[model samples]
Target: MPAPTRALLLIGPLLLFLALVYVLPFLGILRWSVTLPEPGLEQYRAALTDPLVRSVLWRTLRICAIVTVLSVVLAYIVALIWVRGSPVQRLVVELCILIPFWISVLTRAFGWLALLSNRGIVNGWLQATGLTSDPLTMVRNEFGVVVGMVHFLIPFAVFPLASAMRSVDERVLMAARGMGASRARVFWQVFLPMTRAGVIGAALVVFVFALGFFVTPAILGGGRSVMVAELIYLRIFQSPNWGLGAAISVLLMLAVGAMLAALLRQARPGGGS
Candidate 1:
């Protein structure tokens, strides 16, 4: 068979699987968003105007933004270290970063719960040390949610950055150093600009992942810090408002799609240059 035909044949099964499992179900959701319980825009209007939904959407965006920013900063630092470190140091740091990615999301969230809860490890230690009489509220709040999300997102941020940093020429830094440039100057002027693509890519990845986060926020928020995903769950499963749930889901999908489109446009040659 021709090379192009052979490549398509190899990918055909995966495409079929995606169509069956993803495309069809998503199409169903779009249909239900408008057609269920009578065809109209009532569900969309309600989702847009509902106070609870507005609050949840805002909270989700806020938390995602915080997580994305924190993750990118921390990951950049780690990736910088990884790129500049010795082979042994690189291996150890990479293991530490990748180890968490192997664990299940629910497992990691529960681990945070145990460590951050009122009577959890940190609070217990604080009380035992006579630092405070009462356990401080940590888990089941925005703080806990951000902590979990940042932890989860850091690895994602690191990989892209590490790849980008590896592409940076060390000779450029050597030239700057030989010219009597300060270390900070070399990093700020030469290194950071070279990593812009990685930073943007990592930020986009973390933000998108954070927006769809449900398990971490649900477990950490304790009903008080509901996010968009949890709100969708409640609308669909708890209240049986399928139409509204579908509408919210569609909105979320559209928002994510728009972001991806913008990112793609910027990525094109001379598009954002």
Candidate 2:
């Protein structure tokens, strides 16, 4: 067996599995999006032009943007701390971060519902403390949705950033400091630039994940704050508009593919300085 043939043999099962599970199903979606009712572009045009679909798509983008920014900022701080912390501190922080990842997303969302709802723990505390006369409407809104998404996505943002931070040479920082550079200047000039790739990678990962989120937005946003995923659900299950749903899915796939391509270009060697 030649080296290339042996390598192909090793990867053949995984490739076959991906084709069977991913490629075939995706092709089915593409076919259905166009041909469900009749072979035409009606579904695609409707999805693009429908006011409701446009609103939902915009809302989804807004929520994902908020989640990505919040997750990246918070995760960067945490990752920086984790990188600088002692071994025990690192272990404790890692455990805290990974604990949420181990739990089910549904469980976490529901738990947030209990904590953020009108009569939930937070409101209960506010009222008990005479902080406000009325229970604040927190859950089932944009604020709640952002909170849930940020919590869910922070771990994802953290791991990539931590990997990037770990790759950064401490000696560079020492050299900068020994040259009489201010701490902030050293961080801004030396540290952040070195970690740019990781930051971009983490943001891309979080934004993409946030786009497809269903359970968190559904539970936290209530009915008022519908995202694209929830809209897709309603189109398929509630309204029985499978064609429209598939069309929306197709558009989303295209948008995500374009983003992936752009990011890949930036990630290639000699792509960025």
Candidate 3:
């Protein structure tokens, strides 16, 4: 076989594995969405025009946006400190980020629930301190959802940003300072520009993860606050509308794909997308 053919043979198993595990399953969902209750566009049409669907989609987008913003900013700070911190500080920071990853998502969500519930510690403390007469509603709403998502996503953001920051040259910052550039100037001109790729990659990862988030949102968001993933679950298992569930899932995948495509298209070469 030619060199290209030989290479293909070597890589074929991996590609086939991905296709079988991911692509085929996804396509099966698409098929299910279109096939049930007769092979037609009705499911798609309902998914598009249904007010409840639209509202859930909008809420998901809004929460994702909030989570992305919070995670990115927090990650940037954590990454900056990690990259510039002393050895002991760096170790502590890394551990702080990694420790949460070992903990289950449900565990983290419940922790937040304990902290934010009306009669929970946070509210109890606030009331005891006379900060407020009533417990602020933190959990069981958008506030809870965003908080849980941000907590879960922060490590993802930090991983990429920290990786990117590590690639930045320390001498470059020193050189800029040596050349009489102010600290702010050096950061914006040198550090920020160099870390652009990592930041974009991190944001993309966080946003994608946030889009399909189920457990955190389900536990924190309550019934009134529903994300698309939860809605899809309700449609399929609770209501037994497999076709509609599949359609929603497909639409979600398309929406995520479109956003990622737009990010890639719009990003500059040095910037991560």
Candidate 4:
């Protein structure tokens, strides 16, 4: 076989799988988005103008942004520590990070609810210690949703960054320090720049995952607070509006695509932290 044909033959199965599983379903949702509810961008219009839908969409994006920021920052610190720390320290911190990922998402959400609820341990301790006159609302709100999502996303952000940080050249760092560069300057100029692509990639992965998150927001956010994913669920399962649900799914995919595109654009050239 010709070289190009051989390469295509090798890659064709995986490409076919992606088309069957991901691309086709995505395109189907895009079709549904247009066809649902009398067609012609009605769902898109509802997504923008309807007060409830708009509020949920805005809240979801805001939470995803906050989670992405916090996750990236925390992951950067943790990744640096992992790269530099003693073996035992690295083991402990890595395990601490992985433990959350291993735990079921539902269990994690339930644990957050237990800790943050009115009569839960956190509030109980606060009341006993005179931190407040009464239990503060924590779970079943925006705060709870954010807390859970951030917890879930930190690992997603950290793995990429840690892998990148591990690949950094220690000799370069030492050389910078030897040349009289301050610790802060060395980190900002050398270390951060080297890890920039991984950071952007990690942020993109976390943000996109957070965009379609359902369980964390649903369980922690209560019925009052709705995310796009939960709204999609309501449309499909609750109201039996499959078309509308598919339309929202398309919007979700588009939102995620926009984030990926932005991150990719920033990733080009010499972009860094």
TM-score per candidate, in order?
0.95, 0.96, 0.90, 0.88
- How many pairs in model 2 have backbone atoms within 3 A of each other, for residues 3 or more apart or on separate chains, i.e. clashes? 0
Model 3: per-residue lDDT, tens digit, 13-35? 99999999999999999999989
Backbone clash count, each prediction separately: 0, 0, 1, 0
- Winner on lDDT (1 vs 4): 1
- Candidate 3, TM-score vs. the true structure? 0.90
The Cα error of candidate 3 at residue 107, in Å, is 0.9
- Residue-level lDDT tens digits of model 4 in 129-162: 9999999999888899989998888888888898
Number of clashes found in candidate 1: 0
What overall lDDT goes with each candidate model? 0.91, 0.91, 0.90, 0.87
Cα lDDT of model 1 by residue, 1-273, tens digit? 899999999999999999999899999999999997889999999999999899999999999999999999999999988989989988988898989979999999999999989879999999999999999999889999999999999999998899879989899989999999999999999999877888887888888888889999999889889999999999989998999999999999988888778668656665445
Model 4 segments more than 4 A misplaced: 1-11, 262-273
TM-score of 1: 0.95
lDDT of 1: 0.91
